[model samples]
Target chain A: MKKKENKIITDDIMIEVEKISMRFNLGIEKGFSLKQGFINLFNIKKRKELKAKRKKNVFWALKNVSFKVNRGEVVGFIGANGAGKSTLLKVVAGVMKPTEGNVDVYGNICPMIELGAGFDPQLTARENIYLNGAVMGYSKNLIDLKFEEIVEFSELREFLDVPVQNFSSGMVARLAFSIATIVDPEILIVDEILSVGDIAFQAKSEKKMMNMIGGGTTVLYVSHSLAAIKKICTKVIWLEKGKIKMVGGTEVCDKYLKYMEGK
Target chain B: MINNLKYVYAKYSFLLKQLVERDFKVKYKRSILGIFWSLLYPVLMMAVMAIVFSNVFKFSTPGVSYLTYLLIGLTYFSYFSEASNLAMSSVVANFSLINKVYMPKYIFPLSKCIFVGINFLLTLIPLYIIIIATGTGLNWAHLFLPYSFICLFLFTVGMGFILSTIAVFIRDMFYIYGIIITIWTYLTPIMYDIKIISNSTLQFLMKLNPLYQIINFARSIILYHNVPTLGQWAGCGVSGLVIFIIGIIVFKKNQDKFIYYV
Candidate 1:
């Protein structure tokens, strides 16, 4: 209901990230344990530094980044490693709350951040489908309705009864992709899941994504694959070191490609 | 609050069911007698403890057979220990899934408690069997046993919420709680009588333990064949509710930060 209230005011905006900033504590290794904490307690200089305003261990992963995506717009995030693309995606998907500012998303998000994240390896593939479906917020009856479609799409009919622990990585990826895309999500956040499985399965998954996109599912995509970005994205945001460096169409991606090539 | 509960139940009940089923299945996957272990574990533990306490330690039971008293207390206490221990790590165990998706983080602990609670309910069958075997025949008062079980269930869930939240930040709690539960078990008078404690202050402090009150409620109904006094019911209810509310408050306040730490 909290997510629905704002949709009434800005119906067209599928996602509105307002000056969102996310900070991660790099001090996890410093005093995380009780032993380390006790040791640090007596170290006066270290304690004073911890109390100081400019703490060295705080790393801002995203800084005052603002953007809005209208309904059906496929917005791509292009960035080098550690450039805050995944953190921003997580914030928009409502997985991680921003340290400052707000992210207002109008619809349910299917985040393909790491596929098969919910799969219990000890369980059979058949069981994992329902378990993963429920984790994805699907009801039992809904999953039952689409169970066959998922099995057929994954091409794992012969291996459904086998535990996921025995599954080849490609088969697991196929099943994860099929279950994730079974229902057309209201908003889809894809973080580097396009490279799933073998080449044939990759093409199949891309076609499935295109079908979802054609049905007006707003997408936030992040990938290092520039060609894939140019193929699917209507607009692109280039990130550099936790800040947005550029925002535009495929032309920005071309510029990014040239920039990377020069480097 | 009622409306909020209803909303959560409607939205996430299916997920909770799936999680419980997953836990149940994964726990019993390779075992021959899957759920029978729930029934057998308590009975087996009671057999071991009943001999040691009654023979070696010579603990006396005034009204009921020592077997019945020990089994009742052991059954209820096992649920608390098992449920709380599992619930403590529920959040940390599911970190991989939580890192990817947006979920009400409280569900992980809640699901763990419910799963262990189901196993606890199964253990009651053996408790009743032992009671009947010991000639403490079933009585109408035994119908009121659920009152304490529900209270204990709520108390355990609240403890679980608080523990699970702490576990997200401080990984040491898992090991620390093991020792705490062992010390708490001895302090609860599960295997021995409270009469052995000669000091009135010590006895009063022991009575203040919530597990003692809940277990006493069960003992009154099952062993004594009498309804617990109104004061006893009030005490048990307040302890359960107070702890449950505190757990929820702590869990809610800290849940948003779990993603960062987890």
Candidate 2:
């Protein structure tokens, strides 16, 4: 009965995650040499030792995670570090496929997953804008259309030719935020972008996000700030150690907050 | 596969351009010589080889000047090594983007090929000037330049894709590839002549190396001043296509798994 509904999408379902799981194999690595590698491959006792190590290497980053994202909904993901927020986000973005189950997204997704995700520090601010825009899936013509607006918003008029490596951290953050938000993609996946730069810039960035939401774009956001999540997100998914502990409205936030206080 | 390709290209074609440009910019930054180094490098190597091979060993070119003969080989071999080495590291080097961003993994290796191809372009004018300077007459066979280049370019990009994928799984690939490329360079008869080899079996093995086939293919047009035989043309196309097709399939299969490893 449940298997029958797995593939179908009714109205208002923009993204659907069904029992997605991710497993990471982690291990200690000795320094690499061809001779050492070949020896490790053949040694019987060493093979058994390696097998034991492999057992210890298994890390379940996400386990049986299921959710649904409706159209034009701003869903917030709140979790502690290593709670699989980014992992789950990557699976939904189709950057990484899940080990089990699947995610169905019915919209064009533009992920601002990490600030300056494709920027070369050695390249100038102007260069990075074009590069980042391309990474955001904007064509060269589209970038040309929005290049001046990005520069104006960044307010680095004097430093257009200066390499981004030389820019201040806050200044770099401004440039990154400006490029990510310049064009509103259909389904925006934002990860902690609002916490960057100075206070005024944060406010300005929040306002830009509000404008995108107003334009009927769906968003899946990951952030550590509960107050900010409550202010912007209509629904919240609280992840705890690779599991969806609770899912609801601000009540989920209240329960998550209470649980955090208890912990 | 066609639909998938169209989607990725439509989405990230501009990103691919910026990435290639970024590589060149980073490569030449803070260097006084800048891109002249691209031209200077092969020429300087040829000069050193001419002294040792021509003056010391007195190696012979059958009809063409030894300078032009060695320069063509050096130019092509350098392009092969540079493109492969950069591409081998393409996936691992872009670890930050692989995990954080959503661009296709193939773009990483493809960008390396594009970057090296740009540097290869800098080698041509100097090559043409030398060909004219050494009294090597330009012929209609030179029209095959674009054909030879496309074959070589496909071959390099294919190798890059395969190497970058393997490097993701095995860290030792970094060292293993160096040894492999060195052995490959020596076996290809780049600095030495094919006529010097006496063993038919060893000679046959040398012919199997695609770079050997590609270099001679270019040399046929440039120095030999003749169009390649249909058989030679088929050899270049088949080898390049087979390698490129295999590379794309392997890369696509493992691309999703890469996020975990990278």
Candidate 3:
């Protein structure tokens, strides 16, 4: 259960997250160099002190989180700040490994976890489109065929040869969103990415996402906008302090909203 | 495990090629010379080494051209050090992509080695040019030069994996590796002839370096126009295969933990 197993399945289940728990070191010095690592290795007293300090500093971001998503299910993750929504999504997307348990995802995933995650600012928008496509696991021939469509969707045809660093934030977002959604992924993992770009482009991207979802793509979406959740999610999982507080229909979103408002 | 290997191959091999290409484009983006700099770099370094050692230090090999000797050693050593150094920071440099995407982590370092290897192959143009200019006439033994290149490439990839993995945990690795490579370059007999060393034990120890084995094999084929001895052949191939195997094992063991650190 310690490994994330990405398998292909013939049945309906697309993702299975089993008791996945992730822990982070909350100490101020979260990272140590090899020099410090070596010093700690030789110093027994310091090692003992560090071990004791580690227990107090350990913070679990996700704990005993287990769930399953059927093919084409639009599942929304709702949580307050620091309630492990992003961490859970990362574990499901295979970006981060869980500390205790494992996750099994049964299909190709397009993780919109971070818009323009692999975009290099130094490269021109034309080059970045191909690079971003590669990062999302698309072959060159496929990207070549879809290149014109991506540029048209991004509406950056005039700025294709211009370096992405010179582009406005909206232009970058438009390019990222276009490349990410170009292919019809089997599982789409979105983490607050719908809020990208201007209002008009946001509407366009959401419409594109709805088209994918309508075509039987399983989606794991994390967002704070309850209205968006209620509109898009068929099921909602409300997380609280590293654990699931509720899992059900959109009514759970209503209940979570009440809980937040009451607090 | 076999199925997993196939899955990764089917999925990520194209991504690897793209990453290598990206490194190439970004590295040479603003430069006027573009990738021709790869060829000119070693040529310039060889000129400096020949002037300093042949004229000032009075170092020379009796039968072989000193410039050719220095170029071969300089070319290969730079390749190894440059590839590994770039690879050491490869994981940390790509942290933005690593944190958000699910691609295999080893691709970053492997891509760096490949990108540098392409540059290394370009440097060979100068290497062969100098060889012919020095009257070290081409011979049948030169066909075996690819053997040395293959061995050196494997060795560099192995070292890249290990260094990139270590870099994930130790941010200081970049600085620490700088000092180590400086010490290594001086020890590898790149400028001075190995025959000048007075102590047999010290010379034997120098021979223990895997880099020396690969470079020495290439020198034998190019400069001396002879096939490598059985010992040299074994030394080059065995060290590369052994180190590459160890590197793979080390990388695979630590890769899962990399997401936490990088």
- B104-179: candidate 1 lDDT, tens digit per residue: 9889989989999899889989987888899998888877778888899899999999999998888889889999
- Best of the two (1, 3) by lDDT: 1
Give the C-alpha lDDT of model 3: 0.88
Q: How large is the interface RMSD of each prediction?
A: 1.0, 1.6, 1.5
Candidate 3 chain A least-lDDT 10 residues: A1-10
> What is the per-residue lDDT of model 2 for residues A1-263, given as tens digits with 9 covering 90 to 100?
01123455568788889998899877634334567679988898987787787678878889999999888889999888899999888888877788998888876787878878778888988888888888777788877988898888778889999999999999999998888887767788988887778888888878887798768899898988888789878899999889998888877888888888898
- Model 1: per-residue Cα lDDT over A120-166, one tens digit each: 99999999999999888888898999999999999999999999999
After superposition, which runs of candidate 1 have C-alpha atoms over 4 Å from their true positions?
A5-11, A32-54, B1-3
* Index of the highest-DockQ prediction: 1
Candidate of highest lDDT: 1
lDDT of each residue in A64-176, candidate 3, tens digit only: 99999999899999999999999898888888889988788877788888878788888999989888898988888889999999999888899999999999999998999
Give TM-score values for chain A, per-prediction: 0.90, 0.87, 0.88
Worst 10 residues of 1 chain A by lDDT: A1-10
lDDT of 2 by residue, B200-262 (tens): 888888888888788888888888888899978988887688888888888888877776676
